[model samples]
Target: MAFVGVERAVRQILQDDADVFALVGARVNPAKAEQGPATPYVVYQMIANEHHEMFGGSAGLANALIQISGFSTSKSEVLDLREKVRLALQGQTSVVTVGADTFDVRSIHLEGDRDIDDDPRDGSDAAIYGWAMDFRVGYPEPVP
Candidate 1:
């Protein structure tokens, strides 16, 4: 499969994806970069993997990328999204606005990946593969 379209996939999900509010903090505090309009409030990303971005300093720039992030077509797809975020935050990237709502994402990074193993099927006495996910995201604020 082609990996080039991950950006579109991410953008599509961020805008059209349901369950957005649950992944975000209960309230918005613009004082926190990670909670402000600039940041990508991805509640689905958090829920899918049960992980959130690590924030430090003022801007909380994500230094690490989430492993097994649910957003990418492949492992490296998240990194491409990161570059898009970097460009957006630096005024180098655009067209990320979500719907008529005007939501945005920033300070992108990979949070981490989830590890999974095969499950033994008792019925057939066979092994079955399963899937797990990890979340990676960028914070809008600088690391404190």
Candidate 2:
């Protein structure tokens, strides 16, 4: 699926970055958080997809809204990770290969980002900071 292509491309780009890997250690996940990673980790999910119609009402393109979140005990560190994810995804226009299908990513637009604070799960006084970023990705339909 086109979403698969987009996810693969995003994961590949983020994992290839030395700074991101050093911080998160390959903690990128799809729609779920990793059970036991030190402090910082990343989780991504495809929230929505809207198919675009051509002049004759035939849909051949779509835009996917993907959410990538960074969680850490340090606010600054999580924000930095959010920035890294943004840089890796924004404005990408490459042809990504997923399985046996090739899809072209038209563009990646950062919709918005926010910071979250929550109490620790271990009943500690400290709070964990999470940074979430939403990216709107435009890509071609998967070849059938």
Candidate 3:
């Protein structure tokens, strides 16, 4: 399915930020990070999307709830990454372009976040520390 551009925009915004880039480089993924991926990475996914409707049928706008995950071997690193992500994204309003696609964003608001510690699959390795942050994004629906 085609998206309204929140996912791509989120990745691009994070990648473009100096602070976030320093921590994660280009290790941002859409749904899940690569297997045994590098530490201090980010993964994001859409939790919900809804199109605005007018009295006639549809409005040319959409709102989505997106969750961004920051992962690291150290709790301090993960916390720092999460703070950088939040700083880069919260209360943003802009026209963002990702490749050939563009998103006219009305706003990006920080919804909430929680700490998540992943238990190792082998049960002997050290756990992964992370935070899952939710953002509410409003933008115009994609054309085509």
User: What is the TM-score of each predicted model, taking all chains together?
Assistant: 0.28, 0.82, 0.90
lDDT on C-alpha atoms for all candidate structures: 0.31, 0.78, 0.87
Q: Return the top candidate by lDDT.
A: 3
lDDT of 2 by residue, 25-125 (tens): 87888876755456788888888989877677747788889988888888788888887878888887777665575667889999999886655756677
Cα deviation at 135, candidate 3, in Å, is 0.3
Candidate 3 Cα errors over 4 Å, as ranges: 1-4, 121-124, 142-144
Reference-based lDDT, residue 67, model 3: 97
Across 1-144, the per-residue lDDT of candidate 3 in tens digits comes to 334367888888889899999999999999988877878899999999989888877787888999999999898999999999999999989877777666677999998999987665345587789899999999887443
lDDT of 1 by residue, 62-81 (tens): 32232222122233433443
Error of 1 at 132 (Å): 4.2
Q: After superposition, how far is residue 52 of candidate 2 from its true place, in Å?
A: 0.6
Candidate 2 vs. true structure, TM-score:
0.82
What's the distance in Å from true for residue 35, model 1? 34
Ranked by lDDT, top first: 3, 2, 1
Q: What is the lDDT of candidate 3?
A: 0.87
- The residue pairs that clash in candidate 2, if any, are none
Runs of candidate 2 exceeding 4 Å displacement = 1-3, 55-57, 97-102
